[model samples]
Target chain A: MGEFDLITRYFQRPAKRSPLGVGDDCALLAPAPGMQLAVSCDMLVEGRHFLSTVDPARLGHKALAVNLSDLAACGAKPLAFTLALAMPGVDESWLEGFSRGLFALADEHGCELVGGDTTRGPLNICITVFGEVPAGAALLRSGAHAGDDIWVSGTLGDARLALEAFRGTLELPADVFAQARMRMEQPAPRVALGQALRGTASSAVDVSDGLVGDLGHILASSKVGATLDADAATGVIAAAASCGLGTEILRTCALSGGDDYELVFTAPPAARAAVEQAGKESATRVTRIGRIDAEAGLRIVDASGAPISQRFGSFDHFV
Target chain B: MGEFDLITRYFQRPAKRSPLGVGDDCALLAPAPGMQLAVSCDMLVEGRHFLSTVDPARLGHKALAVNLSDLAACGAKPLAFTLALAMPGVDESWLEGFSRGLFALADEHGCELVGGDTTRGPLNICITVFGEVPAGAALLRSGAHAGDDIWVSGTLGDARLALEAFRGTLELPADVFAQARMRMEQPAPRVALGQALRGTASSAVDVSDGLVGDLGHILASSKVGATLDADAATGVIAAAASCGLGTEILRTCALSGGDDYELVFTAPPAARAAVEQAGKESATRVTRIGRIDAEAGLRIVDASGAPISQRFGSFDHFV
Candidate 1:
């Protein structure tokens, strides 16, 4: 029999009124009254995402958190999540730590650790998070429109730098290493700011793969382009510089490097004031770094409107 | 610095809620007024779950169906599901088939494939399904009580037999081979039976790992014990024997086999009439085989009510 036949025999059953259940361009979920649904998932591997020597508790937490960031990105409040944990052994300590980390995050986020599966194989962790946005109000990547200013909520590249430090590739002073490693170890999700942007911002996505990569998703999905101000784009480097690091290196890390977990979004020019207002209230900086363009590709320009040459590219999982 | 820390830095977000959101034991959603939520997840691995030579479409479909079976097991109405797919390459045809298979099931079940992830790896899939159960009506594994009857829906051991055939340990006529392969390739989820059992059964679970192993979970969770009639347990073997299989081999296969995708449930004494009525209306066989016990461990009894010498075990991922 054909694959579809097989899947149908096993998957299809009685259903409620979901317009597209299990098969469609995308599944649409309408949240309950006064509640928004949170959504998140993470991709993990043996060598690339983790090492065999790493603690399991932390691994569990990290796996759950990656998905949590997606909820943060959508500005949906976190609720519950399922974990898909693949491993070669039944390592108790690892499971204990992983569950600890996962539940710790769940506790903090007011979410629950519900369903999951444990299969045998190389270590791969994939977690899907569920959150809620008010009915008909979840933020999407396609809401970005031309003339909307692009903004990112936090410092980037610190995670990548920490990765370097962990790998022993880039040397760091004690203080810088501590801070950078902290950024890499425990990323602070911008859930508060994301909630604030729900009605105010037009398009949004979490910075997962890298700034350029996630931003490109918004651009392509929205059928718009962007021109980043290199100065603002490299503000992360400036912060690194103030901490006695090379701006160019940190800029490269911020641009092309990933694991940032920040929210990069677009708000209409009219909403820029609201963003500023939100920044003041949240005590978190939301920098306007670029503007959506009528054109269909991305470009980087200086304040003077001159294009800036950069070597950064999107994160390619296959490549 | 470590992998887990690295992951958490990017993932944890704040939980906001209606009923089930992000940080709970499970995500809850009321897609429609008074409708229950469907829940399921699929886990895929590279070498174990699928062979590189297998059609990607089939792989994807199988991935989706496995989780849908979980929802079917729960007797909840299907709604939507999320997928986590990991691959080493991006093959358009593979993705096309995978999507086709997935969508076909979704369409048939009125479920929408709401969200998913694509990333680089050794190829693993994890899908979590969402469905709904009327308030206070979700079927569980712990509802079986003393004097309640044990039941299983559909044929069993076909998937395990198919696996054997795949490994070339078993030889069959081409038609039988095809049938066995069909059993493996596409399993019929007992959605109708599960739903029918919701109001009538005391406890239930979809048979995945193996009857014994999966049933162990029910017993453990329900904090109850069971005494299976070995003769009735071997009834499937007798059925196969009439179809030309040897009794002993068929018995072993039925006992230790996994991947049947059938629902194994317990009906309370008071619900027996309801169970038979529901089964008749649903056109699904509900076998009566055993009874729940006050004891705290599973027991296998012969036709004369004496303990059998045969050991009971099922598939374990680790052991």
Candidate 2:
């Protein structure tokens, strides 16, 4: 079948929520009246974003999931998305698996696949997701203030733990590895949590580049520093304790290993009750591991409140 | 600098027309109330869409222009776009040139660059553009009637002529080659013409994959056939006559050579005057080259009304 036919058969669906869908020059979406449209794009390249042996279905899910996480960070309601794909050649089985995984998630979120381009090239998936938010209600990275309590949804470092296992830098029991692999391959986007925290969270960002680095973005954008409770941060390591990682290794992975799709947000201390309510409503765990400060740089404090001096780097595509 | 820094410095601009711009996880755009969002995506891969030697600025312009053309065909007013780019390595000079061309066109159309991802990989550019159209005003591909006149804006075949010359299959005067190359690399998106033709045109599509192939989309969608005036269609060849192409070559190039980025629409005879007025207002030439028919397949008739049997193929990535 031709490329267009393949897309129509697999990716194109009756865009029930959109004004128009695939098979046209452009898809049409009408955001709810008085709402602003939130748009973001994310691209995944083979070998760079995923292992060569990764399942097509998981890859597809991850591709859309990452972009959706961006929407979640901004407290936008899932609306629609477009997928631009490039592949070395046509493979029906691969396409089937990929589309199935993609549509499954899209259906779950009601984010209809609208329109895109497919071409012959190295495998790359680029998705642009559209969502909606009330004017001035979006959770931005520039809104955190001094004395705000910083919170993260869900545990981090599991995806990084799985990556290390894949790279043979670490060893784990089969069941433990399986759980971590699930985190690596299919990290859940905190869309509900974001929407729930819309009014309470002063600033938010998804932890795609490790906790320390992603949080750095909030600090830089908000022009505030942070004091992280090292012991509380290390609580993420308990999820990986079955793999027998030492404290130093666990700390490194939790701080800088990357690939976690959790939401790290900030709110005033007085909003702690609202934040907890949001977490309960979203059915996601919330952990307060830091506090915003007026100082210009990040500081990690030990259990005794003694400051620790250690540098952590985030993943940069060109670095 | 890192990839994020590169994007901030080169791509991030104050989104004057949008609710929010590039720094946030999702860019927010609020179209005029009651307007539907028109969205389309196009990806250009180096070595497939353009030669490695093509100017970075033109390559960037073409990447966004092709997507803009899709919106134009839908009769939408350009609003905003997101760019997802992957490249083998970072080059500051190349990026400078590319961003210059990209922003120049974006500024002209008032389309803001919203948010996107940049990663390390083979050079590929995927742009998703958003536009606004009044409810039920979008020119769709399924609205053509059998008696409607098939019309094309601007011209065609020049881009194909340039491709052939680049591939060393044809010879041309230096000046002619330059002109054709410009047409190939920098074809203008007919945004103004598309908006002007909104109420008058029944159905429309941009001519990207040659006139025959793109028109086929309209015919297939509208469930109609067409009878083409071969002589008028071949008039596109006159523009390339200075390139020393033969009649057969000219006909093939004009009918099936892709990448022209012109608009092809169908209108009822009664709306011909309105179509002409739109053309005049947009300052673009519109040509009526054929008529939709109730027959099951496309047919070309010569000046004397004799049938011309020639098969034309559209450019397919897989084929």
Candidate 3:
């Protein structure tokens, strides 16, 4: 089939909220008055972002979910998104499974597929998502203050543990591997927690990279450093129980594990109860594992406040 | 350099019109109160969309130009765009040239680069553009009338000529080849003309996949057909003068050329003068090439009104 036929069969839908949707040269969107449009784009490539052997359905889910994580970090309600997909050739079952996964997540969030482009080439999925946040209400990485408490929503390190197991660097029990693999394939974006923390949280960012590396972005933007309690951070890894790993493994994975679509945020110490309430309301686990500091660089500390000497580098595409 | 550092050095910039620019989870934009947002996306894959030997700077220009053409077809004023690019590896000179070409066009239209993604993968560039049009004023492909005059802005076929020459299917003199290659590399988008024809035109579409195929989209959307004046269409290909091509070659290339990023539109016969005035104001050449009809499919006829029998298929990625 041709590109248009492929689009019509898989992606086209009636526009309900926006003025126009698929089939038009350009989809039309009008943000509600007093609302600012939050836009973000993400591209996923085989072997780099996902394994070639991954399920097509999960791949689609992960592609859109990653973009949605950015919207959640900005505390923006989902509106619409454009998908640009490049593939090797036509695969009916792959397209069906992929669209099913993509639309399931989209429908859950009320995000419409507005417009997109499909081409034949090496597999690449790029999504540019749009969301709406009220004027002056968006939570940005620059909003954190030195005295704010750093918190992370949901669990981390499971995705990285799965990667390690998959790479044969570490091994897990069969059942444990399956659970970790699920975490890697399908990350639950902390959208509700982020929306709930809007006015209560001082700053926010979704952790796709390692906690320390992603947190460094907030520090650089907000001009403040952080002190992460290594023990407290390690305690949040849910996979630690089933994996029979050492404390060092747990700490390293939890602290520097990328691919965790959890929110790492900060709020003033006085609003700790409010942050806890937001987490409770969103049905997400909130863990306090760090604090913003006036210092210039990150500092990792044990329970007794002593420094750790080993350095766990985060994932970087190029170095 | 790492991905973050690459972004910082090349794509990061402070927000002037947007509430938030690069250093955040999402870039925030607030469209004017009465304007509706127009969104479109296009993906360019290496080997499929362009030649490997093409200039990197021109490749950047062509990528954004094609996307902007979609906005132009919708009669939307340029606002902003996001680029998601994947490359095999970092090449400083390539990035520098690409950025230079991209920013030159972006600055011309006041379309700021708000956010994007970069990764290590097979080269691909996906751009999602945002434009704005006053409510109820944007042109659409579904608005054509049975008796409307079909028009084309600027010349066609030169880009196809350049392609055929490069493929060794045809040949041209050195000067002629160079000129045609420029058309192939950097076909100008009819942005100003589209904005100018906002109210005067009945329906519009940018011709990327040849005149007949792109016009087919208008016909299908409007539930109308058209009789294209093949002679007039062939008369508009400027490359004919130096290419030493016959009538058959000119007609085929002009009607089925896929890379010419020009506008094909329709207007009522009474608005012929107004269409010319719009073209004049926008500094573009306008040609009346066909007429919409009540029939069910496209018809091509010579100057003598005899129907043409040859078939010229348009480009399709999956076919």
Alpha carbon lDDT of each predicted model: 0.68, 0.89, 0.91
* Model 1 lDDT, residue A128, Cα: 76
RMSD (CA, Å), each prediction? 8.4, 1.2, 1.0
Measured against the true two-chain complex, the DockQ scores of the candidates, in the order shown, are 0.17, 0.88, 0.91
Better of 1 and 2 by TM-score: 2
TM-score of model 2 (first chain only): 0.98
Q: Regarding TM-score, does 1 or 3 come out ahead? A: 3
Specify the poorest-scoring 10-residue window by lDDT in model 1 chain A: A19-28
Model 1, residue A114: distance off in Å is 0.7
Candidate 2 clash total?
0
- Please write out the lDDT profile of model 2 over residues A203-259, one tens digit for every residue: 999999888989999999999999988768778653586667787778777887788
- Per residue, candidate 1 scores C-alpha lDDT tens digits across B130-230 of 77666556677667777777877766777777677678877666666667666666776776777787778888888777777677767876778888876
Q: Which ten residues in a row have the lowest lDDT in candidate 3 chain A?
A: A235-244
TM-score of every candidate relative to the true structure: 0.84, 0.98, 0.99
Give residue A309's lDDT in candidate 1 (0 to 100): 73
Give lDDT: candidate 3, residue B157.
Answer: 89
**Superposition error at A204 for model 3 (Å):** 0.7
| TM per candidate, chain B | 0.84, 0.98, 0.98
- Ranked by lDDT from best down, the candidates are 3, 2, 1
